[model samples]
Target chain A: MHIVDGALSNEVVIAGSVLAAGGIALGLRKLDIEKIPAAGMLSATFFVASLIHVPIGPSSVHLILNGLAGLMLGWAAFPALFVGLLLQAVFFGFGGLTVLGVNTLNIALPAVLVFYICRQGVAARSAITSAVWGGIGGTLSIVLTTLLVGASLALSGDEFIPAAKLVFVTHIPVMIIEGLLTGFAVYLARKVKPELFAELTVSAEATS
Target chain B: MGHIVTSGPQVLVNAQVSGGNRLLDKLDPRTRIITACVYAVLIVSFKSLVVLSCGLALSLAAMQVTNTPVKATLRRMLAMDGFILFTLALLPFTMPGTPIFSLFGYGFSIEGLMKAIDIALKANAIILMLMVLVGTLEPVTIGHALHRLRTPQVLVHLLMFTVRYISVLHQEYLRLRAAMKVRSFQLSNSLHTYKSVGYLVGMMLVRSLDRSERILAAMKCRGFTGTIPLLDTMQFTKRDKVFALMVLFFALLLIVMEWMIDTTY
Candidate 1:
């Protein structure tokens, strides 16, 4: 989730900031005027999605929906998530300013994976298959992000084993929750907003 | 997380703490936001535990003088204590320095404990500054601050709408949960409930989109531009400059103290 400032090393924060900047640049390059509304809508949806809490053992985890964001906005999910997170950090202090880059990259990379995975599955003519891919993608993304956070902390001379174990164990329930949420979200999208799929297909075709 | 559900009293306390005071209320929203941001940066930049402690104490004193209730602040800090504990628990195990004590096959170091305390203090300071800013400033004023900060007009507008719609969405979520409860929907250890939640979210998204379109149309009808005009311009007075300078001076002083301690100790 959100890493507060001073939790990680300054090196990690700087590196994250650099990588996030690159991701934002890459994401912005593919923007089309028509996609602006989609981006806005997706950003708003991402903002709201974090509010719905799913109870875990001691901590409540909410649906990040980064995978769904990927499915909907494709590359644009980067900026959408970034902006959404920035607002959350600034307005509600959900996260920290220095760690913004790391959090965004952690979430957006998986979003990109979901986008590509969904693209391939849709091309294979199976919405359910795509949903499954989306679900797995969402779950793995969170796991990877947690691992990265752990690794970053460990690399900074923090006890690697305990932090790693804590992060990994804490995330198991949340990952399962994310997978379920992603699967159902994709299914619903396919049902109610079939045009979204069609638009993705059209965009893919246009790109090719 | 389940504890958050039982946090109604805590939330009420926090709300009351934030609701107190009219002095901060009188400042321009942009100025308040700038002050908050500056405070966050200054607090984070310092590595000394003492300075962080002092910063936190100063912030609390400001809150107290502004009539912010102690119970409210304590409740808010308690909610955040979970995260702080997580950070603290990691420090003694990971940080390197002269070992102070050994417990349960682990060595606790002075450096680690100090670092952890510093982190906790900085986090608290930032959170306190943010609470004061948000409590004092209106949402529209925040929007104006972002605009003044030269954030993207489109994104600012989106945020404006998003903030406006958040309450509506919260209400919708409550209604949905109530309806589910009325139908005797038992949420248990099953994937089915998650899918239901997802479906609900998807439906909400669609509704929100439709609502946003209507809002856009209405704005256009009223000759709304992409940018929202600020009701009051953010002007920096001599007093504002003096305040800003004082903050900077204290921040530098803290940084110096941290450096001296790190070197001498």
Candidate 2:
């Protein structure tokens, strides 16, 4: 769902940048000293994790792991994803700098949304429940991202509607793969170090 | 449409190509970054093919000035613009307008071809500008530029650390994958495959968190403060300002031409 540069209308691009700026600000405020290094490591982890490609058909896709990042980091996923996208745009030319805001918004907003929707469930007592929720989070992130990418393109002009639909259609396989991968990942984390998720639960309970 | 197909080794190879072109490398990172952002907007907003072509020509010149090798740059363009190419191929068949030509009894629209070409040109111009601008700056330079621009401190630090440790973690990932492959593990669309890859990523996460702890300790030992002070600062030179102004002037000219075309038509 990386919306390449010049793919979006100026209106969508400008609006995305504004919203992404707000997200970054909120994420920065939430980024405490303790979470800083963890955020950094997670950002790096995301950077590397995304490079692992899995074959689907003639073309291959890679793990976005934004769902896991949001499940783990909450709002901090904004800045973390922003950095990863920025690096990808700058270093690898995966996306363009012009559309970085749209790309970040498309990818990271779903992450934040998943955190709100599934973080609690992902911290559930039973590993099975946590894994299931994590899977849903992963799948939902891709679904939302593709929708946003499609919406961005479609809103650009009616001419792009077919292409936008094509994007969503192609992403169905990615959704399934990412869902299963995230389920297993959440399951493994629960088994190995339950505290990793326990922290979020405790923090949420404290805040509430 | 282009998801990440490149591998860890490719990422490692890309890490070595940090910014340092004679022309672009000399400009302040801030100037280059701002100009690129402005150029992106200008190029994307352009509706006229003629104006977009001018933008493309200027971007190409900038790429040449930055010493970006043409072949590698074109490959990057292909990777990034693959979806646009697909759209260009499909536009004529689906887009409604006067038919320009027909293939296999399918009529292609003149307006559709123009729109497709417009999108392609804009995409090319923006990518070329970015390849010369952002691509010619080191990661640290970008981080520092962000800092100097008074971006959020936490975000800048996050970007800096991510840039620093990505290569390290990538190497770790390669080793782990190598270990898995040695055991004859293959990536197939199966639950078993997903589970195993999940374990691999999970293990990497665990290691990364542990390393982050150690890294924080190491930094604290060195009297690390919350903010990293810039040891090497970039100063905006007169020449840099002149270059930025010249670019902006040309960009304005393109925008004006686009506006004129819109008004005249």
Candidate 3:
């Protein structure tokens, strides 16, 4: 679901880069050094997670887990997503350097959003509810990003209907898959590693 | 050792670019990043195949001037050839064109073939340009560039640390895999294998959280402020300006050339 270089308008690329830069700065301001290793490990997980492709129709789709990252990292997901993307661009060429900022924001924003939503839901009820919220949030976030991407392409003079249809059609199944994956990932975390859920619980408690 | 082997060559290329100068290294990482970003934008704006070829040629020349190894760059591009191959296969069937050849009821169009070639070339050009940028620049430098370019500090710092620790987690993954292997747990079935992988990922998440807590404690001890302070400032020399101008000139040249070709034909 990553947008390749030259696929979008120069305006979007330039403007998106600026916006992403600001997001990164904000993410860095309150970052604690202790969080570095966790960020690193999670970033690595994000990277490795993408390597396993789950087949979807003619084209195969991989798990992005932006929601999971958001739920765990919060705003920290920006940098984690950025690093994972950079590595993917360089090592695997999945995305280009030019579109890095835009792509990072697209994926990471959903993650950050999921973190907030899940935190709120978990405070009022059970872990299962939080997990379900995270899954739904993740799916919605990707859809939002896809729409944004499609809108950007359309604004750049691409035939809006085709571009929108292409993005929406391809991503619907991916979104469902993402929702399931995020739900299961959260469920698995709650089961095998309760400590990992501590931060999410604390954030949820604070928010609620 | 294997990691070193994989990363060493790229590091050497980058070291050469930095040239052991603290001052040069300190220049706004954002400036370089923006320059690269602009180059990518200009390249993708062109639809003509000839212009893309010229753009690729120009990028190669820039790499040469910077002392970047053509072989290494090509090797990296070669590694990503699978995607290019996929694009090539799709283009001929999907792109509109007149039939030039047919095989087993499948028609191949000359126009489609040309367009596919153009897409392939354009894609590679973009990829090569990025490889050079990422290869020569440090992750922190790139992060700093983004900061200067007005990217959110949180995202930049997060990315910086993420790049710093990816290998650490990779090592953790290797250890976990080794342990699993030693226990004689067969991971031959894809479904069972994925489950094991997921569990391992869960364990990794727990370990990562613990590590982050420790890191936060250490940073607090060091009296770290919210922002990472730079030890030096990056100053742009006349040479840097000249370099920037040259890139702009080439981009314009490509655009004009495309215009001329379209009008003439």
Computed on alpha carbons, the lDDT of every model, listed in order, comes to 0.68, 0.81, 0.65
Candidate 2 TM-score to native:
0.92
Clash totals in order:
2, 0, 30
lDDT for each residue of candidate 2 in B154-174, tens digit (9 for 90 to 100) = 888998889878878978988
Ranking the candidates on DockQ from highest down gives: 2, 1, 3
Candidate 1: pairs in clash: A58-B1, A159-B94
Q: Which candidate is the best by lDDT?
A: 2
1 or 2, greater by DockQ:
2
How well does chain A score by TM in each candidate?
0.89, 0.96, 0.88
Global local distance difference test of model 2: 0.81
Candidate 2: tens digits of C-alpha lDDT, residues A48-82 = 89878877767678889888888887888889999
TM-score of each: 0.85, 0.92, 0.75
Report the error of model 2 at residue A177, Å: 0.4
The digit string of per-residue lDDT tens for model 3 on A1-208 reads 5666655667888888887877665555435554555666677677656654555556566567777777777776777777787766764456676778888878877677667666565333466775677568768777877876666656654323354557777689878767766666666677666555676567434544
Complex DockQ, candidate 3: 0.29
- The DockQ figures for the candidates are 0.39, 0.59, 0.29
The residue ranges of model 3 lying beyond 4 angstroms of the native Cα positions read A9-41, A48-63, A74-76, A90-92, A109-185, A192-198, A201-208, B1-31, B69-72, B97-115, B145-151
RMSD values for the candidates in order, in angstroms, are 3.8, 2.6, 5.4
What docking grade does candidate 3 earn? acceptable
Q: Per-residue lDDT of B76-124 in model 1, one digit per residue for the tens?
A: 5556666558857777866677888888877898887887777778777
